[model samples]
Target: MARDRKPVKSKGGRPSREQAAEINGRILSAATTLFLKRGVDGTSLEAIAAAAQIGKPTLYARYPDKSALFAAVIRAQVDAAMPPITGVAETATPAARLRQVGRAVIEGAMKPVPLGLMRLYIAEAPRHGALIREVDRLGRQAALEAIAGALAGAGGADAIDRAHVVAAHFLDMVFVPHQMRALLGDVPDEADPLHPTLDARIETAIAAFKTMHLLPAE
Candidate 1:
């Protein structure tokens, strides 16, 4: 009887690419909900799997562990929230493109999910130095390059310093201040960080660039 035992077959249907993507999406949504509700340290893999309605084995099959899963969630959050600036080069003028990029940056910063992830990352930065560095290298540095390229296009080959300045100012004006506020829980739910009033900040940045002759007068 033991010798006649049949080979066990794999259970369930094979997951198609679409199905896998759907599962990944569910996992991310569940992880995001838990991360926001309980903070990174407070949340657990079991909870995520439960929230996603998937078994622990399935969750681990998709993501090896919590750190990998957290990184995936952060990467997804950043990618979805931040629109790539590649197309900005197509604009007729540098100032126009810069302004567009600036607006995009502001909008991305103010988005709720990205803001939450940003807060989470900052909170975890001290203990999770490697993860923080990975995020900066993967997300922030890449975005900075795009901004620098746009600035270079606007300011010309001679304006490298100006480009860097503009890039730094752009980040500070749009993200840093609001991010700090988010970290402090000072941002009201209904407050719009991308409101027209925020245009003053953009205008000030533009003016600073203009003072250095990096941009033409509007």
Candidate 2:
């Protein structure tokens, strides 16, 4: 018979706040890696716990189920990829701000890590429609709010509905085509690579948005 194993005692008091934060970070880091590799549905809490070097009870303490854990991961990824916009001066040119915000959005979304997260999110979307919808809602709200503000300023006397329409057009010009190309795969070697460099794409998108919305309206 195997020798009787000694029982491990809990640390008695709960982990210190700092220690708990570190553990949570560890969990998120592990989950990000696995989710990137295997996608949301493919990954399990047991795998996440193993990857984080934590026990099942510990993982359960923080995240009771896969959707809860995934929601946490998705929120983190969404925030990281498309962080909330703040601090533009009230009088700043809306077009200039649109360029700035548009670039940030594209760059964040196109990074290798976030790009992988997006693919994973799409892969898991068929099953988790509501979860994906929530993420989309958050992203759209941030993007549209800023873009619409910019358009509102640019439009001056333009109606709010028209300003919003123009804002949607701006996003379509800047984000849709390039994002779709990237998501689909790669362009032909002979073809332009979706705007040469990231900054160029951003600049071109801003120019396109202006041509489509501003100059035409003038």
Candidate 3:
């Protein structure tokens, strides 16, 4: 008779907080890649789990379903696409600062990741309309806040109320038009010496703000 074998000890235990966070990051990264490549509807949780090297149960535990995972991916993209306002305008003239902020906003929006995410959203909007709209609202709010932060020192305390309104207009004037052109495949490269270049738009926006007295007194 063979000797009785010793009972095997389990090597598994709960993941450390850092390890859990790293796993979550991997899941989101994998999901984003799959969603962008295959479109959200075409991508499934099984695919995501396989890409992430995690079990389906793990993915489901973090995100109840595909929509929830998609929402998380979009939220992360929005956060990345909206640049931080801090230190962007420090030590610059008011007009210069506005231009810097506007440039940052445009560049952030035009980045490959954000553009890919936008394409994904547009393709999947029919089924995820509400989710997409909510994501848009959150991104817009964040952009407005960043623009407002750039306007802080220029605008006196009394101008605070109008800052957000002006910020919205500024975003529309400098960002929305360019972004629309970009989405339509009509956008010229930044290095292109063409009519209505990025700098031209920024200058025009500054002039409009000055004429409307929308910018605070300098």
Considering every candidate listed, which one attains the maximal TM-score? Answer: 3
Compose the digit string of candidate 2's lDDT tens values, residues 1-218. Answer: 11212234347756766677777887899999998988776888888888887887788899999888888988887777775566655576655666666666776677888778777878889888899899978876666766666546545655456657756775676676666667777642424764455556656656765676652322
**Model 1 C-alpha lDDT per residue in residues 1-218, reported as the tens digit of each score:** 01111223335646666667777898899999899889989999888988887778778888998889988998787677767676765545667777787777667767777777887888888877897778766766656666767767755567766666677777776556655665576643435544324566677677877877767776
> Which pairs clash in model 2?
none
- Candidate 1 residue pairs in clash (backbone atoms < 3 Å): none
Q: Against the hidden reference, what TM-scores do the models get?
A: 0.75, 0.72, 0.85
* Backbone atom clashes (below 3 Å) for every candidate: 0, 0, 0
Model 2 gets an lDDT of: 0.70
lDDT of each: 0.72, 0.70, 0.79
Query: In terms of TM-score, how similar is model 3 to the real structure?
Result: 0.85
Residue-level lDDT tens digits of model 3 in 1-218: 11212223335756666677777888899999998888887898898888888777778889999989999999988998887765664567667777778788888998887988887888889999999999989988888887777766666776655667678888887778777777777766656544267788788778888888877455
Indicate whether candidate 1 or candidate 3 has the larger lDDT: 3
